[model samples]
Target: MNIPITNSIRHGRRYRQQGMVSTLIALIVLVVSLLAAMALMRSVDTSNTIAGSLTFRQSVLQEAERAYVDAQQKITFTQPTSDADNAPLGYYAEPQPATARSAGDVPNVLVNAVSGSIGSVTPLNSTDNSVTYVVERLCPTSGAATVTACIVPGASLLGATSSNQTSDNLTPFDNGAYAAFRLTVRVNGPKGTTAYVQTILR
Candidate 1:
């Protein structure tokens, strides 16, 4: 009878040991699941931040177009003459520095143009984004746009004297018939987002 009692006690001890091991495994699984959940949440937050940034950038780009249109209207209605430096109207008969069109941080020329009495400011959207633009004729000096002084699109590559009459039967593309103008639009948005859009027009 004593042997049977001892054997029953050993069986009880073995069952308790198995139960403890099972509990430990469950606790480890729970910890691992919690860590995974935390990682997933972080990933989702990162994705949301990236998406929001992209959307904001796109909106800023669209706002730039509005400024561009305003510049166009100014050019059409005001009709800049051969005179240079129409600062009040944001029209310059002379070309801008290369730094204005460079990539990376905002150019000093644009900052000065916007801050000073040059370029007109127009509100972009309800978010308080504003735009300013400067139009620069691609010419070294003021007065009339000459072939040697200005950048003319579709100008004869062979030479200024070369005529296209034989090939296309059309009159020779005049090298200095029209001048090319560069439109630089700067946008200032919320959270200190600054963007520049530039285009050449003839």
Candidate 2:
């Protein structure tokens, strides 16, 4: 005896196989899409963090520069160089020699001024930036005693020509003697950024 399979049964078996394959493809696509979305979000977050840091650094630098200028404006040559007793509230007559650091280096002060006004301490801004400054007269000694000791031109000084050429001429800088002072500013921004600025005014 021999038996033959029916066409309808064969067709139904084929349709079931096709449906299973379609379901598997959909699941795979969903997983890939989820992973891509997550990576994209992380990239965006990283970019935002870097941008915010740069903004903070810029803000702090600007605040520090302002303090440096302010310190110069508030103090004059007549002011004392050292106010050891009052310190921060008063301008230093002679620079604390320990803090007499070279240009671009932090001043070697016993007490670093953060804020408030005694001498050169800058007031805090309405914004988050906090500013402070120190003014140091460029002389080895403090008070009027060192007045002549300061850099004063006698009769000869190498003068600058319009061409800006240097000469060994021994005329003693004829220009009027000018005493210079240093202004150092420290700025603290809202985002934990710090900046230092210094200028020498004659």
Candidate 3:
């Protein structure tokens, strides 16, 4: 009878040891699974952030391009009108009432032009990304040009007389026009990222 009782006690002890080992293994697995889940979450978050930033950058660049195109069209349609009191021959004239040919009722157009000139540094979106742009016109001149100049010696013609003429130090447009205008756009992205784009408008 005593031997049987000792055998039973030994069996109970063995079962408890096995149970403890199983519990330890389960706890270790749970810990490893939690760690993997955390890492995956972090990776997903990082990817999302990158995608959002790229999208914002593209949007800002597109907006800048639209502004540039609108300015070009305005200049083209207005037919190079001189500023009030002939201040200077700027690419963009002052804001005027909407016409049928114009982009009509687009307040953002004026806002973009003003912001670009004044370095207003307005954001592309409400999420802290921003862009600033500048518009400049290159007119043929004889001397002392402000932004860019194309001057021909001994010729009274402006932007003409290519022979012996001083062309703009800047690269001319692909169309080979003696005079062309330019727009410079600078984009600032979140987390200190930035990019620059320049386009020529004739």
Candidate 4:
């Protein structure tokens, strides 16, 4: 019969397919390896970006502290005038509110500190990492202790003016009036990094 010839042809084709099977498997393995390498590279890139951001934030924070101290010194020693205070000096008796985004903040100088744009605030440095600061007396405006939010110890309070050697329990306090001052600092650095810092002192 012709059956033997047909069977031999079929066996030859199967043998050819077996020979190419290894090549097909090798191609699939190569594709998978390439995908894995790409994924690993992307993960590495993301990690690097995060680390860079953290480093930049820390640097800007240090710069902010310097501006805060400067603002506090100015508050303690002298009053800032419109003439002396500007973009470079960062000192202001009044609060500047952030206009674009208020969130639920009350419309006041204190709220302005959080919601308003400081506008080219006083630059602390000449470089790109320059910082700025503002000083505000806690009161809505400067005035007398009765009219303003000043805190002062009473003269009749014990230990206000007592000497360590004095056994007098009736000793009165003599500390002068003190007012709270708030300092706000901002810094702009490389990579669009920005930071804000606030400190309060009396």
Candidate 5:
């Protein structure tokens, strides 16, 4: 009878110890699973934030390009009246009249407008944003000359003596001339991404 009692007591203690160990292991697993879920959620949030910033940057770049093209067209079609001498119109500058020549003396106008506008849509870490752009025009030749002289000689048809003969006053251009008039654009986004674009008109 004494041996049987001792055996039963030992069995009871062993059962309790096994139950405690199992419970402890289950609690540890539960804690680890919760931590993993939280970490995954944070990572997803970060990715989404970066994607939003990139999208906004792209939109800003498009706006800048539009502004560049509009300025170029103004320069091409319109003649520079006396009002444009001291002031010049640009991406960010005040309105200046485009340069012009006599009815037909103008060379093929190369719209060489360049821009370097840089600003953040949002603060580096903030949610709100703002942007800025800079615009400039490049001359066709090295020295300062009237817009008319820039075109190759005989390229103008307005002064031609024979009204019956229309001169194809087109002038050939080199890569160097084309490169001389380039527009540069820079966009900075939230997070640390940046975008740049360059355009030229010949």
Candidate 6:
């Protein structure tokens, strides 16, 4: 009778140990599932953030383009004659190096705009965003847009050898001499977005 009672107690202990092991395995599976869910959620959040940033960047770029067009229109209509710094009108006679506001560098016109002295701040009626532009003549020095000082288009076309024409005889674009101008447009849009757009025109 004593031996039978001892064997029954040992069997009971073995069953309890097996149950504990099963429970522990189940808990581990649950933890793994939870970690996977968290990782997936974080990936989704990162994707959404990237998408939003791209959209905003595109919008600001469009604004910059519109500002560029506005600057071009002003140059076409006004035909400013002075070969000097016309800060009030956002025009520079000499060429400015390609600078970026986002690169910890400041544009000359922005300083003017901030000081309330001179700058062309054109507001876009559609988006209610303000844009600034600087029109710089591509010239070595400022007095006039002469051939010796200014950059003109079709330099390669001027001296082309087509087997029939010599470099000196070839006339490019009907011997037209036009000074190239650089238009730099900066747009300040919603959500603290800034963009720079530049184009060369003749």
Native RMSD of candidate 5 (Å): 12.9
lDDT of 4 by residue, 1-202 (tens): 5456888899999988987897899999999999999999999999999998888777767776677666545433223232123333444443345333322212233333433333233454444675655665433344332212332222221222311222232211233233344565556675666566665543
TM-score of each: 0.65, 0.51, 0.48, 0.58, 0.45, 0.65
lDDT of each: 0.64, 0.54, 0.48, 0.49, 0.40, 0.60
Question: Evaluated with lDDT, which candidate comes out highest?
Answer: 1
Q: How accurate is candidate 2 locally (lDDT)?
A: 0.54
lDDT of 2 by residue, 106-191 (tens): 65552365344334434455666766666665555664423344432231222311112223431112232234455666666677
Better of 1 and 6 by lDDT: 1
Q: How would you encode candidate 1's per-residue C-alpha lDDT over 1-202 as one tens digit per residue?
A: 3345888899999999999999999999999999999999999999998997888778767776776777766654222353457767777777655463354233356766545535765674576876777777656677665555556545442243321122332212233245556677777777787777766664
- Give the CA lDDT, 0 to 100, for residue 156 in model 4: 20
By TM-score, the better pick of 1 and 3 is: 1
Candidate 5, 1-202: lDDT as tens digits: 4455887899999999999999999999999999999999999999998888667766656755664655455443212321132113323112223335332111112122223222212233342322332332233333332333333232332331111112243212322111113344444555454444554333
Clashing pairs in 1: none
lDDT-based ranking: 1, 6, 2, 4, 3, 5
Native-referenced Cα lDDT, model 4: 0.49
Which portions of model 2 miss their true places by more than 4 Å?
1-42, 78-86, 94-103, 108-126, 144-176
Candidate 5 collision pairs: 80-98, 80-99, 80-100, 114-183, 121-129, 121-130, 122-129
Model 3 residue 148 CA deviation in Å? 12
| Stretches > 4 Å off in candidate 3 | 1-5, 70-130, 136-182, 188-195
* Ten contiguous residues minimizing lDDT sum, candidate 6: 157-166
What's the TM for model 2?
Answer: 0.51
Write down the worst ten-residue block by lDDT for model 3: 82-91
Comparing 1 with 3 on lDDT, the higher-scoring candidate is 1
Task: Output the better candidate (4/6) by TM-score.
Answer: 6
Better of 1 and 4 by lDDT: 1
